[model samples]
Target chain A: MTKKVLVLPGDGIGPEIVGQATRVLDALIENHGLDVTYESALVGGSSYDAHETPLTDEVLAQAKDADAILLGAVGGPKWEQYDISVRPEKALLKLRSELELFGNLRPAILYKQLADASSLKPELVSDLDVLIVRELTGGIYFGQPRGIRTLENGERQGYNTYVYSESEVERIAHVAFKAAMLRDKRVCSVDKANVLEATELWREVMDRVSKEYPEVELTHMYVDNAAMQLVRAPKQFDVMVTGNMFGDILSDCAAMLTGSIGMLPSASLDANGKGMYEPIHGSAPDIAGQNKANPLATILSVSMLLRHSFGEAELADKIDQAVSTVLDQGLRTADIHTDGDKLVSTTEMGDAVLAALA
Target chain B: MTKKVLVLPGDGIGPEIVGQATRVLDALIENHGLDVTYESALVGGSSYDAHETPLTDEVLAQAKDADAILLGAVGGPKWEQYDISVRPEKALLKLRSELELFGNLRPAILYKQLADASSLKPELVSDLDVLIVRELTGGIYFGQPRGIRTLENGERQGYNTYVYSESEVERIAHVAFKAAMLRDKRVCSVDKANVLEATELWREVMDRVSKEYPEVELTHMYVDNAAMQLVRAPKQFDVMVTGNMFGDILSDCAAMLTGSIGMLPSASLDANGKGMYEPIHGSAPDIAGQNKANPLATILSVSMLLRHSFGEAELADKIDQAVSTVLDQGLRTADIHTDGDKLVSTTEMGDAVLAALA
Candidate 1:
């Protein structure tokens, strides 16, 4: 009984980097006797080109049945001309909507090997690891009555709602609290409660959720102060749960704390335990098919998929160790290749990681 | 006829710092023959204690009738225990609602003397100045249908609608464009149009607004990307305009880029050009009445009031030069007293700045 996994090698450098990840997946299945089946599908700009649509029903059907989905970077300059609904980036929004992927897990881990990559002092960046559990399905991103309207006076108005139901906040709060229970047993809920009525309710829901996890320490911080603290002392955070827009902005800031887009991976999860894993970086259409794409992020996405979706914690640890080992050995892709001696092509870097695993 | 000005020196070191600014304002009137009138008031915990309300009707009336208002700071641990609506922070929010202050101007300027205060390298922070024109009145802050409600399933729901009519966006766009014309003549309109519908309208309105400022180079960026870029290369930005929430967050980030919070000042303007000036830093309750508080921010606030509301550009420049001269003379307050041998008390620092004017 092989566990079915869907690999969506999306637009731009998506295929190139995911190709390397797939090689590692195959190696895992062969060496570890893991029961797994990999299925490849086109998404984003590639899907738009193949079928004249960003995401077709045929692909969605395949995706719904898979145990977990691993997506590479999506969108490129080629699809920027498309209408909003059919744009390559729309594919990602569509997938998340259809799949009900509500929980977004963005881990900001500062690898010791790339300490020089960060803008902060080496002492501040080293040994920094914090998990941000962002509520994705609700909040401003999908709030209703959102759009542009042409007024009677010939003025165009733009508006978006920041709406959150109790269940919405409660469900995500549980995700963060449960995550904290597994890790450092601390959860800091970030919101603009003092200014936002929605966030006030968000705080209330978080208060109720915290009662369920008495063992976990819960703290609250305003989003602006949280932004400052992230730069001031990132290591102070354990697991932070926040709304969609703040989550999106802060997660990107957290990623920069790691110093390179080539090192971060994210996970979007739903209530049924199903998950979608992807790297935080976008498709570098400029360097597509050149074997110059950084594959470490995609490989880390696979690592997240194993631990978060399949419950293979040991296997996930091995993959993470392999990445660290490769870095320690001075193998680097173009993005992380600071010193000339550490330079390695995408495939060679991927191979080094695999060899490190051995 | 002398113009009336109300000074609300609320909690922490507010009173001590604001005292210096008021003294400077008096000196301008006495020595420079400027017509002015001033009244000092309390509006935070101190107000709650003496006047029984954070902002009494008498204080509100004075603020309404005054040509300009200068606020020192508000909120402290003493007021955090009050109910959310009645908290010290709400006093500030209530004033904004009453005054109809629609445009918030925060200028991030790295003074040559304090360039080393920034986390970034001196080269990155030196001579960097950016004006963030944030819409203060509209968007999520005052939008309708906001708060918590009970659903059919007996579950509580919380929501906030972020509504912006075309006219609202137009007003803020005009503010940004006009400010850009006065400065570097470029504006980057930031929103999340790709995902949020409200932002789509925001973008559309900006598109229409751009036609009016044909000479101004207009560009659009998602808020998340804008936050990253602000940290990456803040010097590249001239003027940035965005919705209330994004502006609130981004301006704070920009403020920290120069690394000295005590040197920053902000101005909120109304439709009729009535303005309120305030320092970006809150009341430091820890240092209150200790003569250790920084008066530079309060002085800077007066500078903004002179330039934005009174149209006294030369007077504003003189005030700015005085503060810069004080910095060059190695006068540092407690919070920013990192530079050895430059530390000076609140009154002494004010005297140094005023003497620099001579």
Candidate 2:
């Protein structure tokens, strides 16, 4: 039962949140009979400041050796002027590429306690759970010939390729279909098949993969229509699968569904069973030391890591129920606060979840 | 002061809603001393059923000859299985490509009375006005090498190109800047500049364009973050510009900000002086003949066409004021109905707007 975890608490509030998640990990070991080993490394702005590089080979090697990697948020306004190759955000790109973590699972769930925090109607935002399976490592974002070039007449054109091989489509489709089998047993593969050849190939591959999962009902939607439908009626969707670029944008939009950004977590998985779990939010440099930044997203990431990567389903459920219990008890973080609500600091909120777990 | 207008009630609820808009236009000519001419033509599924082509040469000729074009919604399930070359959606694409309508302006405004239809908080969705100026002619949607091709390895890889020439970026930037100057004087250029070269060029061109209009505060946002911000804090934006595909997707997401889908309208302006106006919603075939579809969006499009293309500023303002007056009268379309709310049918709602105008 020994499990090795690499923690990359990149910058800003990362260390504080990771510190709390580590404490919860220790509790799992002490009380739940789970054997755990933990290691910490610097990345993003922290790594850039320390070693003049966002990601060093030594840290990358450690990350590869670990069974799972948990990331605190990365990048800040201070690192915004850095060169693209050495930018703090590039550290994430490098980690994702090097690990070949092709499947990004972002679950947008509306917790009952934070329903009022949503811009959406309470009835629409309440008890809604959606999983977005974004094919992370391929398509337009990484395709070749992707730069500015001068034409013969001194004019310039910027170009990027959107290319998808069958293997790329097949592997990601398999991930999405497998995820659908575990959820509501319905999968909607979103693409601009009518317009883009890449999406057509993606759709064909998805169709081929879907046959293996006969229990899941499959549907297709164009990206534009999907965007409209997401607002028009999001309740119709169960599990949505799409390519890297589309997923990156849509997943962010979908996160807004739950009203508060502090309640969401994401997991990116690779072939041969390695996974990276992290909060979808970034380093809030403005609130770095104020204890005002919400830690619930990071806590939820830890819960996802426990269940998804470690296969500790019961422990995962316990963490989730603890989060619900804390909210129900009216322990509000600043981000989810309302009139007459009890507002707690970051550490206090973390402590409340821990207490609820007991 | 004679002006000619072309009306293409494409399909589904196209004729139903466009008919109401035409009545408004007729009223403008008869009651307001505005000289106007209306011409009808075929496009979308209706044309496909009659002529075996969505946009025939005759229809294209009519669109080209007219001073302005008013398009109702296009496409439906009946035409969903058609070939890519002759599909109903292709008709709209062909018109844009043929007309070189490069700047698409999608205005998302939540009417005071219809605020309850939105999933967002009423206060957040009310009195909102944001315009997304999407570049229409270039980028992924119409870029070269955009179809399925065979690879040498006997496997197929789907391919699409996202190319943005300097002039292309410059023209669209000009459109957005000019539009912003007419509004609240802030412009955000959205792109994946960190990842794609075309977006880098797009950002660069926008940077140069911003220098020309020192009065407008120009900002840059990565498309992913921008997507999230659109939902997180939509009020912070005034005018947003991006490439064709990103515009297509993000504009729809932005439209959801108003919570009233049927109340939004759009304009696609070709800088050389021609433009097309339409409701952002599609042909709801299910509600096609039921007198339940909302016509406010179409009526609003006419207002936009008058102001933006025809330069009838006072006339446009009058139309907007009239629409607002009707909403204030508690006249609700079925789509905007709440429990115990007074509701009116499509024609009756149009009558209310006309009454307010009088």
Candidate 3:
């Protein structure tokens, strides 16, 4: 049976970037003995214009039926005037909730060829490879009874409840430990347990789950100390797992350590290994249709999709090596262009990666 | 009339470091003709040993009566086995709560003389000076309904309320704006407003407060993006204000950007501007009584104490310039000593600052 992949080329440079990623995927199927089938659908602004909704039920059904997702980018200034309920960005939240995608994985890997791209000294981040596993569907972000209320004294009080059940924490901890088993077998669970009781339970649940993964070493750190550790010495960590809020902050800090989001990829996964892969950046609306947007991040998303959803680690390695080889060839896109390197167009860089793969 | 200053040199190197700070203060009183009186009190581990409490009632009363408070450091490995209620660290919390020190000010200033000490490239962090204004004594850390309880289904649930009143947000915004007026007149209020309603109200209150300070440029950023920008381009910010949890994380990240915590000072102020000043470092028990601890951070705390509590900007400038001159004179302590720099002990470093003042 051919493995199914659903592609959502949303808006702005989404179509162009996703177009190159598809070509790379096509090359993998054609040259390598791989069995795969993919279908593309419209979403975000384009779908809102064509079908009167950012995400159609028909498209969501296809996504649910597929084994994996390949997403380019979503939302642009054109949809800024739309109501929040029908906005292009709402489609993502709807998909995430509907799919029960509770685990978000973001890997910050700096290729030696682009070592100079990191804000940190090359010695610190040159060989950096750390994966952040964030609990997505739960935590304070989606907790209930969150709003501003008028007090008895006529003063306004704003509140959000941060609650995590044992099961919620357990499942995410399992994801972290399982992820660590695939990597260096070290998992650093970040929490604010020293202060916040919500995360105190989170640490407990993580400890309970760690008993099953005897092969994996687990450690706990305060969130503030974890943030400091990321900047001071990023290479010391292999895999870091946390709640939604902390993951949102630390993952971004880790990405910035690389100094360029143009070449990064991310994954959001459900319990059954079905996942959505996208770049760690937004659609470059200003440069839409100009072929100036970086496609490496999108292409790297393909690498993540294979490894995570399809369990095709070798194929993922092939794609990652292809990207590295092209970077080594000094083929730069406009976004990541530096002096003394040959700057290429979005399509030209994709072509270089395809040639390197061949 | 003489202003009374209360000193609590808590534990380990606290006595030694604060001892040097007092000599510098004494010189200022004698030579500059400033009228100030100070009395020492035992706190932290020593108080726990003496009175079986980290802070005695008499010390608390004196702290309340004093114009400003100077704390050296607190807690050590020896007190690690103490009960949480009687722990030496609890004294600081009790003081913060009792004194109502809601505003926490952390300044990350990369001294030109010690710029190379930073983990970041010297050029990026050379002139870095940004003050983080954190609203202490509130938010999730101290909010109600915080604990772990078993659910009806026998699963445990942990929760904490993240809450802020209009008055609380408004006051802290005022503090941020006023601090900016003293500096470059720019304030970046960080929040998770896009998700959490508590921070949405915080942003709303900040906007309401911004109208009062026409001279200060107030900008709002999501906390995650702010974290990234700190690593990417920290110098772009002047004064950053946020709630307790965020401030705890960002302040530490900012301090690490300076690379050496020994030269950093912190201040916690109440609504009336009476404050507690201290170094942003722990009492190193291992290095205690050896005279190897750096006194710069405690001395710098005196600078913050003079400016915020005493409203004596010129005296603060004198203390700060004396510190800069001492660093310029190539004096160094074990923590921040580099090659070709004169290695000085805690007392010698203090004496060098006194000579610079003369």
Candidate 4:
């Protein structure tokens, strides 16, 4: 069975990075005999420019029909002036809700070679690997009864509901426990149960779901303590699962902790193992086409896409190993480069990864 | 005129640390001509044991009548088995609501002498001072229509409302801007306005509030970016203002950035400048009565009480300078102690500060 991949080179440096990533994918298909076929499509600012909308119905139909999607990045100053409905970021929200991509997996892995890049002491973040599983589609972001309203006293008030059902918690909890089983077998569920009733139920559902995964240990922490612990001692965690908003905040915080945001990849998954993969870094509009952007994160997104969506673990391992080997060879992009390391251009770095793969 | 100060020495190591803080207060009264009178009351586990309630009506009335309150931590494992209503923490929540303490000022300051204690590189957190003004009384934590209900499909749904009125935002924004006026005059209002409507109104009210404080510079950041920036470059901020939940998380994150939680103090202020001061650290039941706990944070809380509530700037500065002088003398408690520093007992640290004051 051939897995169909949709490559969305969104805006700014998207095309350059995704171009490098597809080169590696081409190698995997040609040399490694990986059974996957991919096609390119426009979305975000590019789509808005070409089709008058951030995401056209045709591109969305293509996305829904694909087995996995590889995204470069979206939104830039070019799209900032547009109304919120037609903005480049709308494409992402549309795809997420339309495809029901609820589970977001953000991995923060700090390679030992780039330990000095972190604001934290080397001991704190060196070789740090923490996977944050976030519920993406639901929670406060999409909850109803959300907007500004005028009160009887003529004062205006704003409100949003943070809501989650048992099934929602159960599904995300299973995703986290399954992920933990593959790694350290420990899941720290982050919530504010002591204060928020919504998270209190979230905690109960997590406890109920943990019975099915007896081999995996589960613990609960308040969000504030979790934030402090991330700074004080982040290594104490393996997999941290939380609601949509918490996941958004904690995942970013964890990514920054690695101090090499250019090397992180993320995945938004659906129930049936289909996912959209992308680098955690945003499109670098200022450095776009200058060959200064880092493509390693985008290349790694291909690895995640293969491992998660297609179950091609061996091919994914090869891609990950190629990345590690390139880093071991002291190949650095401008963002992660130091005086002693070789600063390679985006394409050259991608070539190095492809060469290592070969 | 004499000012009445209500002192509440709560559970675990609270009495020991508050005892030390009061010693400095006594010195200020007798030697420095500080016209203040003090009274003590039991709270938390002690109050629970004495009156079967964490906060008695008499004590609550005393707290209301006092010009300022100095507290030395709360909660311990002994009261964990009790129902949530009678729990020691309930007493603190009761005070915040009853006193209308809407503005929570949490300062994360890393003394240069103790910069080595931080997990971050010394250069990043040395002399770092960030005041987080959290709207204590409102937002998602206290929002209405929050509970878990069984749905039509027999699945339970948990929901909490995140809400803010214009006046609520105005008051907290004024708190941030006013505090900024006293400091570096920069306020960064953090919210999730792009997603949550409540925070959209929050941002709008903040912008409207900034007009009154012409000298202060106001900026906006998403809560997620604020969390990352706190870890990446914390010194770039002077004062940060947000709703209850964001403040609860970011303030703790900022506190941990200093890597010396034992030395951070916090103040909860009402609109009228009356406030309650306490250390950010909790009562360590394990280290209770061991003479090993650090009293610096509690002593610093006394300094905050004087400065915020009594307008005794000179006395507060004297206490602050004395604490600095004591730290300069190489005195250390067990928590912030490293290999080469002078390790002193709780009482000895207090005596040293008192001597420095003299």
Per-candidate Cα lDDT values, in order, are 0.86, 0.86, 0.92, 0.94
User: Could you tell me which residue pairs clash in candidate 3?
Assistant: none
TM-score of each model, in listed order? 0.93, 0.93, 0.99, 0.98
Docking class of 4: high
Candidate 2, residue A131: how far the Cα is off, in Å:
1.8
A1-358 per-residue lDDT for model 4 (tens digits): 8889999999999999999999999999999999889999999999999988999999999999999999999989988988989999899999999999999999988888889999999999998989999999999999989999999999999999999999999999988997788789999999999899999999999999999999999999999999999998888999999999999999999999999999999999998879999999898899988988999899999988887788788999899899989999999999999998998999899889989999
Q: Which prediction has more favorable lDDT, 1 or 3?
A: 3
Q: Write down the C-alpha DockQ for each prediction.
A: 0.61, 0.72, 0.90, 0.94
Tens digits of per-residue lDDT for model 3, A128-182? 8999999999989988778999999999999998989999998889888978987
By DockQ, is 1 or 3 better? Answer: 3
Count of backbone collisions in candidate 3: 0
Task: Please give the ranking of all candidate structures by DockQ, highest first, separated by commas.
Answer: 4, 3, 2, 1
The most accurate candidate by lDDT is 4
Model 4: what is its DockQ? 0.94
DockQ value for model 2: 0.72
Fnat across every predicted model, in order: 0.63, 0.82, 0.88, 0.95
Q: What are the interface RMSDs of all the models?
A: 1.5, 1.3, 0.7, 0.4
Per-residue alpha-carbon lDDT of candidate 2 for residues A219-336, written as tens digits (9 for 90 to 100):
9998877876766567788999999999988888788877887788899988755789999888888888788777778788878887777877788888888889888988887778
Cα-based lDDT at residue A214, candidate 4: 99
Q: State how far residue A91 of model 2 sits from its true place (Å).
A: 3.6
